[model samples]
Target: MNALTPQPSHLAMVPFVSVANMLKIVNRIGPAQMIAGIAAYLEDDFRRWEQFDKTPRIPAHSRDGVIELMPTSDGEIYGFKYVNGHPANMARGYQTVTAFGVLSRVENGYPVLLTEMTVLTALRTAATSALAAKHLAPQGATTMAMIGNGAQCEFQALAFQKVLGIDTVRLYDLDPAATAKAVRNLAGSGLTVVACASAEEAITGAQIITTCTADKQNATVLTDNMVGAGVHINGIGGDCPGKTELHRDILLRSDIFVEYAPQTRIEGEIQALDPDHPVTELWKVITGQAEGRRDARQITLFDSVGFAIEDFSALRYLRNQLSDPGEYIELDLLADPDDPRDLFGMVQRARP
Candidate 1:
């Protein structure tokens, strides 16, 4: 067979990590270690933020749900994630969010890796939140109030414990079953998990508050009076237009940090603020170009909207871990023909 021939060769196969393999990878690496590994990659990329091509995620909104494409590149590799958000799916016995992603070599524009990102997204989101908290949260803060106990609750709790040395997490959700589920999942995690009766009780002694509700509207999950001095609020649930968690007055009193200003202005907790309202970019804090946590009394807020570069970092990390042969599967994704230009010949040969 010639170089372009349709032969069973490794060149025509792409490495893919399915949901099962992804779970195995996480199990092998351990969830805390995986979160830390992804966080290290995220920190390295954010420090060299200027080297990346960044853009706001492109979204298509419908009455019931939304679909989005988040893409970014670092000159050598390009990555993008195809994700959907359908809050109604949970009631119908499905995950509210599901995703997959691709990593490609920029030179030849060939895909090098294809993997399920639903689990990876949860890992990266929690890692990114912990990374931000490391910079913005008060030093020696150990307790976190998780306002939403859905799919992301356990991940967030573990990430904080692993990255920020948090030992306790107070959980609260509108649905009591969610709190019960999180409590069960976190049983052996060595964390002091408490199911709170209300949001006020969740934040009683917690220094960090994470809001990750699945609602798609501007719900005042955390009001102004609830938040107090020296608390770092990680607002993750307010990730799209018309979706937010905190009250506007709380935003007015806090030093807001965000992934990207342009995107956060439209989709994050800062969306409640005026267009000219000032916010700090989280990358700058990591790079030491800007300040984080100016004082203990200052309320710090990370208006997280899940940026493309974070997904790019996750894809990059996954590609780096593919050296183990058994960690992934190969799929015949490319067509090869005896002649580079003879695409029709390859199709004809496959016909019985």
Candidate 2:
């Protein structure tokens, strides 16, 4: 450890992965492989869903966007993520979504890992989508229509390709440049990338359709008329109240699966339905407690409003990746004293 890096002898140092180091990790592992790795952890956690304490995310809503804290824990470990969604940020030359997260031991309440999650969140979100599709998408689904080609477009495309053997991604965005950007990024991804003129064109032969626009309203990115039978729709952009992508009729016709029912009922596409609208939690399907896809003709929708467990799994993956110490730098974020009661004295003694 560098001398300038905090090393309080009394405290357990937290390993922090900065944005640059996170990029290194991703570049080292490759995005598709990282998504697959995180998906494995997600599946592991979901299979043990009964062991976790779950709740809705706490959000602070503003006129421009929303910020939220998603938290969850098993008996042995705890984790949380600080995330925000601001649709206008893209126009302002900033990220529409940004986040950071931490994972800590339940026994001592000391964080073992702290990492920048903006990039990690993107990877995990893609992994979760792919995991859901692996269970719910049409069998042998080889093509996907990506309706919004923004920050998450290529990740979704690549994930579906990596996880579902999707060979073609048809891209469309209200802004044509977004589609062009996706086409550019996915050039060497080994999947067939086709830039389409419209949403209808994008879904031409797609068995799976993923709508991930960044608008912060009840925009009908996908109307009922557009969605065909037997198509698996993945809606990820409707992550807050009053914001949705798919039409209510589409949700009514599709067998909707969600991360957490309570949170999804408030912030997912299902929010457009009645309070008593029935849905299945994805964990049940992962754990074999509930059915995923009953037939090839069933329209399955993963109304992904992202849950805390996925973040916990991602943070856990990051923490476990510590076989390489250089992947993160240590930070003295906690104030532990030789004597538990001498926190102030410990601070005063570090005057140099």
Candidate 3:
């Protein structure tokens, strides 16, 4: 260890993993607490939302499905996720969607955490739902109707329970097997789960309705007649351009809210509404700049398109739980030059 010997000046890198490890990390904190924590973080970010560089998510739509890139930063930390939604992939032993995300520091433009986001997406979507419900749902929303009993169903149920104190859930899906799977996954959770024969049967007397179906078209999961006063509908599945859950009449019947209006207008349930139709953004309600749930009888809808800020909040939550246990892969993407003018020499020397 001579004084003249120069040690590596860069920080260590982080390795990404599959959804298996992610499920354990999120479970360790408990989904409800995680959602509550994430909601607070979201509030803080929304207070300064104007500081971030917001962009419309980038989407590559094909005949089969759509893939999207959502990137955002508060001029300090940058994060992005590579997620593909292919409904046909379920039969191929793969999820209909697959995802991974990177968290990077803006100071040196280096990634701090590279991890799987499929599980994180599920967790964050639920958190986002509860976050919106915190502001939009009527007082004492104890019952929730969960539509689409797929991979996301369990997380949404737990999040609403943890974040909004929901104790009862009614489940409905086109496939009875899917609903059975959801009930089995949620075994011993103390949530009163009722399997319903139809979407109308599930949403009958629920305070909150969550739609997470995987259909790639504009399917009407909820119509105007099915909606009740003071119910907060958390629409999840219809996230892409051509996909939607709630009918146009349902949106027209409720005070629809969204994460980012400019982006949601093109992707959220608001896509079916008139261009000039009025709606409130979630951040505004969170910051108290706008009113939420004006009365107990006002119908509300949180048309969730799943914004990047929620992912930013989720990444930050994961970063806090990690202690950098020396678990990462180091890639040499940048070269250290002995002298400022020796850049080319450094590259040539680094070549095999």
lDDT of 3: 0.83
Kindly indicate the candidate among 1 and 3 with the higher TM-score.
1
Clashing pairs in 1: 4-337
Per-residue C-alpha lDDT of model 2 across residues 181-216, encoded as one tens digit per residue: 899999999999999999999999999999999898
Expressed as tens digits, the lDDT of each residue in 1-352 for candidate 1 is 4555446556678999999999989998999899999999999999999999988899999998899999999999999999999989999998899999999999988899999999999999999999999999999998999999998899999999999999999999999999999999999999999999999999999999999999998999999999999999999999989989999999999999999899899889888889999999999999999999989899999999999999999888888887777889998887656676987877887665
Which stretches in model 1 have alpha-carbon errors above 4 Å? 1-6
**Global lDDT of each model?**
0.93, 0.92, 0.83
Predicted candidate 2, C-alpha RMSD: 2.0
Q: Candidate 2, 347: how far from true, in Å?
A: 2.6
Models 1 onward score TM values of 0.97, 0.97, 0.91
Which one wins by lDDT: 1 or 3? Answer: 1
- Looking at model 3, the pairs that clash are none
- State the displacement of the C-alpha of residue 75, model 2, in Å, after optimal TM-score superposition: 1.2
